[model samples]
Target: MTELQLTLEEKIGQMLICGFDGLTPNDHIQQLIEKHHIGGVIYFSRNYANVKQIADLSYELQQMNAASSQVPLFVSIDQEGGMVARIDNDEVTLVPGNMSIGASRDDELAYEAAVICAKELRQMGINVNFAPSLDINNNPKNPVIGVRSYGENADLVSELGIATIEGYQSSDLAATAKHFPGHGDTAVDSHYGLASVPHNQARLMKLELAPFIRAIQAGVDMIMTAHVMFPAFEPEQIPATLSRRVLHDLLRVQLAYEGIIITDCLEMHAISKEFGVAEGAVKAVEGGADIVLVSHTLQEQVAAIEALIGAVRSGRIQEEQIDVSVKRILALKHKRHVGEYEQLTGSVAEQFGTAERKDLIRQLTEKSITLVKDEQQLPLNLSEPTLVIWPEVRHHTQVDEPIVQAYTLGPALAELGANVKEFRIATHPTEEDIQSAIQLAAQYKQVVVVTYNAVSELHEGQVEIVRQIAARNDVALVVASTRNPYDLNQFSEVKTYLCCYENRPMTMSALAKVLTGQLKAQGKLPVTLSPEYSFGMAAQ
Candidate 1:
């Protein structure tokens, strides 16, 4: 059990937390557990089917490792609730996201959200949740951490993030505060490429690093490093995930975070593009990460493990350092009692996605609906023919290709007894598509344009389409299903603007209720969208 007792290969294995390719363990992952002795496994959306399946999968993984290694695997997932949920089905109750909780400004609700997610994860045998993103969302152009973060205010992010951490830990689930020192100010998506934070250490301490500092104070179990460069910290343009000054000097020495240091996925282009996977893994450990996360490709995982082993053998990375990481990982595993996975007491089917949980989701969604602008255009006359212009934008993540789906708003609106005409277009509507929508808007008494994340420059077509339709139609309303409400800046003359904050089914249903006057808009803007319409602005 001592550092001197463990083999160099075992020590290297303890540093890696890898991802496999299937819902169940494949031959490759079995080899990884048996031979590599990897310390953990991180699950993705592809690894889950339902509650029972996830539980079974977690059990299988634990069993696979229990027979081989002394330490149990750290089964982790990105179950951050709203947009970043990996397990979404009828069996799992999806809570509102961080920003939604921040907008509600209810610390209890934030805690409740984390508790719900933690209970569900623990029930499924998942011990670690890479959640409660502590990044202060200071940049509107930030493509990745937009809705994942709580809000722009450091105090708000700190309060809600600490509440979440407390809730998760209360349920015996390890909560990881992520993308340190901060990923909020970057315009680039680190998943696709490297991002740089040009602010000096003073600015970072005040703005970007505030929430993380608070999270460390709140005793977050883990901190995930950002794949971003801080010029003032290192000045080498290397990511914080691979910078000793940022991780060892700042996080350990200055901030004094005692929890495990985990790197963001090494397969991400931010790391993989600049340094090969194996090299990045070595650098991350040398830089002071306790866990080097390799979230894809078995080849890369094996290579990284071999690289770490070689680094330790060559004295580039000392065995004492490896022992330090393994000891921390083992301590967490022992503290959490993460050994052989045990099935929950009751039927998982009945426990998960209960009617009460669904109702809670509905209530939370209702509270998060924000009416940013209104010219007395809401409570739409359901008796009249309404044109529902649905611009279907494909949701894109860093790892996955664009996922396309037709807009369901038209059908949902039609169910409300409105004579609805549905006009569907790609996210970027063609010039013809815009003209056609405009012409069709003339036929209806009212036109409702539905936009998904249209605030970004990438979705300018949707913005243009709204502008043209609003110019011709006197009763044009824009419902922005986005995290940021800055899209309203483009529609200065538009009569109505509604911010749903997210495009989930619960949020969309809440929007319908708000439009029908069944639910009042109670949520204030979490982040300032413009000078005229500041944070805490909402129609009462």
Candidate 2:
């Protein structure tokens, strides 16, 4: 038996993955598949209405490609759980993020999280999940990857990352280890501009590249390129997404990764601002990336496809190179049993937000809450009234969107047999806002202040609010709902501190329990906060 060969247009299409605007298939995306023969499509939160809608959209996209192309389309999503989940709705179960697993220091929990996520994604007709971010969060100032990373230590990151890869593959969904060669140590966010890593090769091997090697050895299906520039690997200061030396000589030749290599979204400012979208796509292919992701704008996707076709015709990009990439892409599709189009059949409604799955989420969250510092103020008297100060914050990666409303713990606290009063503040609180919160705290017997991502300089206002409230009230407690534990270094006057890692619903529920002594704090610090509070320190 012989496999069918793809035409030049079809082969070029296999190298490009695009994103569209509508929840359902639109005219532009349909044309891209029917005429242009695009290899895949990536879904975002904007493309989803509910679980049924997302599943239908995925089925429709596959059917459209089946009508014209020889290969079925690859439907992918960034269902990394926690804050990075794309299919978050009432029907979907939200799991703990990567750093929560790190805090537990349990590799089995990490593997279980991946398995649960894979099952849910497969139920929705999604074949690929871009997850298990292999970056090690060594720098506290890294704006993009905080709780998304496993931990700060290379060995722990390696162990947990490999576990996640195995879990996803076992469940029949292809797993992707993202931002190759590590994006954890960089201070800048690639979404806004180019980020650079100044470490030399030896340093990289010891800290950054360690986990990626483990993932490759574990047989990861795909590896995504980072847009950050590594001066040590490529002297020309080119980003890893466009540098041949880093992708080809290092990853392919040295690391011997036979899996498909995909680029981070070319529309990101790191690539689009430096090189035009079309030109960046061409360079990504030449640099040994099997898939070039143009995740926004139909015009940009078409320009990238046309540019690749022209490059092949002009002998700038060899046809043989294109064939190699298409072959790898086809091989993955066949392995996943998605190479041929077939109508999805089964009752997926039973799998979405099942009681069993939600229990796993609760278990992970309860094991990840770290109580870094506590005086005698913990487990506040249930009979006394307390003021809950909540600060609304925006995700650092999603800077373009409006700020999220304050996530109040008052309701959860009140449910736990306490008299709770809610006081909300803006993401960036004004002087009057801080003063008002301070005045409100004066009337209560105790005050619990919640700060989200206050470790970054951008959230200094939140840190200042904590300082002001702690100065006036003797019974003020600080809850840092962020991955970075260094926020505690700012307010030394605060008697009690808790690190919730993330502000997900499960984590919030777990925090409420811990405050009331219903659940014991067993999670340790995954990373060192300061000299006094080192790794693995937790309140007994």
Candidate 3:
């Protein structure tokens, strides 16, 4: 009877889904389910070892869910390719990104991209994909959510973002359009710090809200709120994540979004620095969020859930409000066919680097790779050895080492029979290292400095490396800027700049193709980079 003993607090706790870390589901997780009956869990790349491993974990998670018959669990992952993807498709398959798709303006590609993402994730026993970032990256200095967005134009963002959702919906995976009203307009990364966009309701509606509205109309399963302030809308101390006006009135009543209203990670800085994590979860739920997300840090999840239960018991939140979220979670779970999807892995693993995928990747990457400033020194007469200086971004705490197998690209480049010199530039390069790069730049007929925003700090060491090389020689800088073109300002002397939009294999292959003249730079700058690198700055 003690096992069956219940409280409204515990019932409310069951409706709030959260995430866990590591490979195995721990006793802490099991206790949360069997005791408090937490509603859901979000998976990350770290929780996965391979396809088979995830299938087994999904099975176990479901088994735990069965212990309580309130509702099925909400299982999710970040499968958005480009800068913020989780699944490892062996470096063969990928989508170029929302920006690339938007630049192409091909609705067909949008459907194809979404279908591919959905199908692959579905095959691995995944039920949800936090994708189709509905942010409009009009702000050039935004530390996060750059090329992850579709483009700067609101109308285009609306069009392509909706198309992406339809594509995901086609394959029966619950697709989420996230960081509502929008996160792309902010100049800060919410992961490490709080961010705000000083836009009025008029500006937000015209720019940021366009994509989310379009996505909702196209049958999005959920809308994830941003942890950003909307003073003109809320007009006070409330971010969209904890604002009833932003979530219910604007999104639900006005935009007519009938789907689940999920909040972004409760642990993120924008929320956490304000109220502690526990109170933040309650605030998000009270703000018209159907599901409060306590993502990241298992310890925080425990504390937040406890706090939520306490709040509900104390009557700070009504019991019916908790039921409302659980009902939404159940509805999404059933619609997603979480119980019916085949438990097969590696069915399409061989599809990576397939002719079709490669072709699409090549095509999309060529379109996305922006040529902001070039000396017109491209189509380089590289009959001679070009000193290729490669920069390593984060020191490897890599999980995909053995599965990544041997280095694929470096050796493959050798087969192309190009004399490529490699340099490993860490996060911070000393003056001696700068001189070495300078000296090397003098010797080579063309110095190709390959850089990316995804791996390295956009404004840190790479800038120093590029500036030093450009100063010394007529450098043919092949900038592999995966996200922001903001880095271009620091390297004005770069003879040829390429925006590969993503650092994934798709974008990588495109960069290689364009470098070898197998392809041409066709992408317009999707966002403004000042008057110098404005939208459509590249050659027509």
Residue pairs in clash, model 3: 92-353, 369-499, 370-499
Number of the predicted model whose TM-score against the real structure is largest: 2
Question: Could you tell me every candidate's TM-score relative to the true structure?
Answer: 0.95, 0.96, 0.90
Clashing pairs in 1: none
Q: How high is the lDDT of residue 514 in model 1? A: 75
Give, for candidate 2, the lowest lDDT window spanning 10 residues: 399-408
Steric collisions counted per model: 0, 0, 3
Rate residue 532 of model 3 by lDDT: 72
Which order, best to worst by lDDT? 2, 1, 3
538: Cα error in model 1, Å: 1.8
lDDT of each: 0.83, 0.83, 0.70
Residue 539 in candidate 2, Cα distance off native in Å: 2.6
